[model samples]
Target: MRWLVNHKQRLIITVVFYFVVLLLISMRKNSMYKYSTETYTMYNISSSLVVSDPTGTFRAKLPVSHAFINSVYYYPTSKSLGENAIAFTMAIDHHSNNMGHHTFNVLGYNSTNMIKSVATAQTEGISRCQYTTMMARTNTLSRLEKIEIESNGVSVEVPFKLARYTAPKPVIICISPQFAAEQWQLFVMHVHAANRFGGHLHIYLTSIIESYFELMKEYERQGYITLDYWLRMKFANPRTPYFEPNQNVEWRNQAGAQTDCLLQYKEAAEYIAFFDMDDILFPRDFPTYLEEFNAVLHANPGKNYLFYGRREHEFVKASTLSEFSFTELVQSLRSSQTVKRGKVVVRPEAYNSTWIHNSKHVSFATSVQVSSPTLVHVQLPVDKNGKRNHSRDLWKIEFGPLIEKIREDDIKAIEEDIYR
Candidate 1:
């Protein structure tokens, strides 16, 4: 003991050294392994959810569109049936300094939680954008598992969930035209002048035409109204193939136009109205027609049909009524004094298929120039002094009491904007 006391410095040094070694051993077992992290950092996963360990990667949910194979043009397994549809794709990036050889597998889960292996792939790429080979499955697949990755003796694992898939919707197309004509312009001016009497009278021909089309287009866009112009012709010369309607063909032309308009709507629409170039329709006319049309359709769900009504025209002199559109009126008139009268109203036999042409008994009844309406306001032209123009022979009949009533009704409820 006396000799040990003389070498106390050595004993102190030995005890201190033993204590330091003991502390380091305890930290290594209970705490973190202290190596140079600069050489190898933990796996930094890029995903929606936060990962607990920087070195370890966790699962992410896959997008539905990319996961599913849309159309299988060619498949290795089947030649005739083509490729069965699969759900979507899952993508992951391995960003590390060292290239890795990795193994991956895909799995799926239904409403009930049974997991099944669906696909597998392997990759050995050298650089960035060099991805581990994709795992593809022929069947509808959803979830994925990154089962293994090997680089420097460490294996990383990740699992991605499959999301629901959906397809895109189809599109529709439109093909109706806007309707306007010279007669509408003339009628509007006369009525506007009739009430107001005088203004600058600044009527730009182009502006009037444009405004008319604009009005028609607005109505058409709302699916409330449509306009049509028709022409009929006889072959003037076979070699030239020149076509011309007879001298008295305008009325028939109008009818043909109306029939053509109805054909475009046969598939989707239930009712169609024929408006003559000379007929002045108030704005309410559209809504009223639609209402009446729907009522007719409601009564008889899906039959090729329509309802006929009397046409009432208000002249400069007095109110008059006719069951004919203006075109039909022209056909009815031989001279102002001579009017051939019959049941003038007609419901077209679905466009491209009017039965009027086939029947020998029906004269003055053909495509574009058929059908009468509930109202027609015949405002014949007048001179500067307000004396009515045109031959009186053109309009000779005084409408019966019932049609006279409708004419009066239309006049009372007419609005100024409809003329505009």
Candidate 2:
């Protein structure tokens, strides 16, 4: 009877142990499932929606009866007179032929004289639209006042403003339209860093959730950043024959966006830096990026491009937060080795075209390579059992105080749910 009791007790203990093990396995699977779902949702939320006028600051939409100016680019032929000559990308009526000709008038600023140019049409395969890219030059206008394009018995008048040329410091254009909610912290950090380094941010928005847009709008209102909406419909058609594969579409669009930004700000910005939201150009010795850039330019006079390699840092989840501090959270993360790829800061006068990583159509002979990195890239850290680690140590040397301030300011935004 005693032996029977012992055997029964052992069986009960074994059963309980197995039950606990199964429970743990089930919990782990559930955790992974939730993580994956969140990631998928984030991807869609970041890329799927389109908002044409978030702030209602854009001009009135053209009447449907008339062809619209889908995309307008102002590339100054002479840097001496900013935006005196301009380029236009116009979308004609659907029935219009690619060979159709039109005339555009540039109404001079505070003058009655009109600069007229004959526009030539071309077919853009990706957009599946017959558009016209016309270059118009006007010496009568000190600056662009307005553009009037007449087509198909309908005329559309669009206002134009030239970017200010008298900016005290050289400008650095940072254009990233596709940003996810998970990147809000990093985005704020990048802005602060850029401002500290004497850089102005020109951010383009392709798609973003309402909450993120609110935060961005606030930033724009403060003059800390400039926000522009990307009208995707104006650029590409879903059914175009040249439509890139789904994965490559975003990549291709990003390249095109970079090119547009380069042209848009070429005359306004003395130097343009093409960087991702996760990247920051840190100066080792100088306090701001402007100082470092000036120093480099002084060392290599008339250099068209300054290339700096990147040191990548991984984000690590903090084990504990003393008081919910982003600065503290960043300090606790881990970093990786320098990335093989690098980014460039180019003089607008030097490069006519650009890619995601490098510039093309180089007009000058001098390209300088800085021995140390002027930029540090902070990427999402490797996931270790669901914990996140960041690359805060790398920035601690030059940006410690700023990071702390960012954390303090961000905390307020977070509490108000302005930042996700």
lDDT of each model, Cα atoms only? 0.27, 0.48
Clashes of 1: 25
Most accurate candidate by lDDT: 2
Best prediction by TM-score:
2
- TM for every model, in the order presented, reads 0.31, 0.57
Candidate 1, run of 10 with poorest lDDT: 16-25
Lowest summed lDDT window (length 10), candidate 2: 16-25
Compared with the true structure, model 2 gives a TM-score of: 0.57
Candidate 1 lDDT over 1-420, as tens digits, reads 111223322111111110000000011222233332333223222321211333233222111101111111112122211233121112223232111332323233345443433432222122223122122233322222222222222222323222212111010011112122323434442233222211111111111233344544564454332222221122211221011112222222222222233233323233333333333222222234344344444555443344232243433321222221332222222212212221121233332212211212233323222133333444353232456555744665454332322233444323332433
Residue-level lDDT tens digits of model 2 in 71-126 = 44443345632345554443232222223333444433345556654444332223
